[model samples]
Target: METGIYLIVTIVNKGWGDTVLEASMKAGAEGGTILLGRGVGIHEKQTILGISIEPEKEVVLSVTYPDKKDAILQEIVRAAELKKPGAGIAFVVPIAQVAGVVHLFHQGSQSNSEETK
Candidate 1:
């Protein structure tokens, strides 16, 4: 059995990172950082009038407890509908150690993302 922290990576069309992070938070995740990326798959590119068009993608990276990894991953897949091709993909990588999060990386983050209304 894998132990220690696990990194959850989710890649989807632009603007979907937020949705994936939201679902993870509800499943015991602290938060995630989003990065912009481009896909290079055969079906990812399209041409219009001889011009090439590439779809923008969002990559979300987050760390969570190993025990909660499965739940968080499941929620992300369900929320992002990754089961369908071309929607997106998600995976987990085991981590040996993590540092520099002492400043702030847990429970409080959920409130920080909450809207004040």
Candidate 2:
């Protein structure tokens, strides 16, 4: 168990789940998890008789090396088309501890470096 692992938070369009996964993998993520959610923002509303509307979303979580996290996040952003409206957002968090994967962490770091080259 160690602190300093990187976690990527990617929120994308509802139907872009597969695209996010492919992008993260291509950018050096071993794997990822997805969760369904709803987006709430200033522009996330409709004016139908003063009614409000919010769009559904998909949140993709990829935990990787501190080094690879950036590239993985970038890939998700690009692939998910987050630059467009309603595409969602992405970020990274530093993990304080993890278990059952000491060796894998080392391997992930090595692979991350290699991929960046």
Candidate 3:
């Protein structure tokens, strides 16, 4: 089955997960999941008082339909300033199948039914 679902994966500096989430929602995404992580990019290497510190990161996962994928990604980029070095990165992966998101499909179908009624 072709679900036409895409997963928008966004990785940004720690504490910016909420910004991504809100942007995704504003672009029509239902919701998203945020996970804590740590990594250092070439532009992110730094030292604090002679001590090196690994940068903390937030990984945001937003599942959305094809129609909203581009808009959601653009919003995330604008909100997170991803164009800046070391700011963050966002990408999309097409999902062949998914589970536990029946509510989203159900709501879409309900609206379609109402429109036809």
Best by TM-score: 3
lDDT by residue (tens digit), candidate 1, 11-104: 9999899999999998988889999998745557788999888889999998887678999999999999998878889999986545565333
Looking at model 1, residue 75 earns an lDDT score of: 98
Candidate 2 lDDT over residue span 21-68, tens digit each = 899999999888889988675556665677766678888888887788
Whole-model Cα lDDT of every candidate shown, in order: 0.80, 0.77, 0.88
Candidate 2 weakest lDDT stretch, 10 residues: 108-117
Q: For every candidate structure, what is the RMSD over all alpha carbons to the true structure, in angstroms? A: 8.0, 6.1, 5.0
Order the candidates by lDDT, highest first — what do you get? 3, 1, 2
User: Model 3: clashing residue pairs?
Assistant: none
What's model 2's TM-score? Answer: 0.77
Candidate 3 minimal-lDDT segment of 10 residues: 108-117
Point out the higher-scoring one by lDDT: 1 or 3: 3
Model 2 Cα shift for residue 48 (angstroms): 4.0
Show the colliding residue pairs in model 1. Answer: none
What lDDT is reached at residue 81 by model 2? 84
For model 2, name the residue pairs that clash: none
Mark the regions of model 2 whose C-alpha exceeds 4 Å error after superposition: 47-49, 100-103, 106-117
Q: What lDDT score goes with residue 103 in model 2?
A: 52
* lDDT (C-alpha) at residue 25 in model 3: 98
Query: What TM-score do all the candidates reach, one by one?
Result: 0.78, 0.77, 0.84
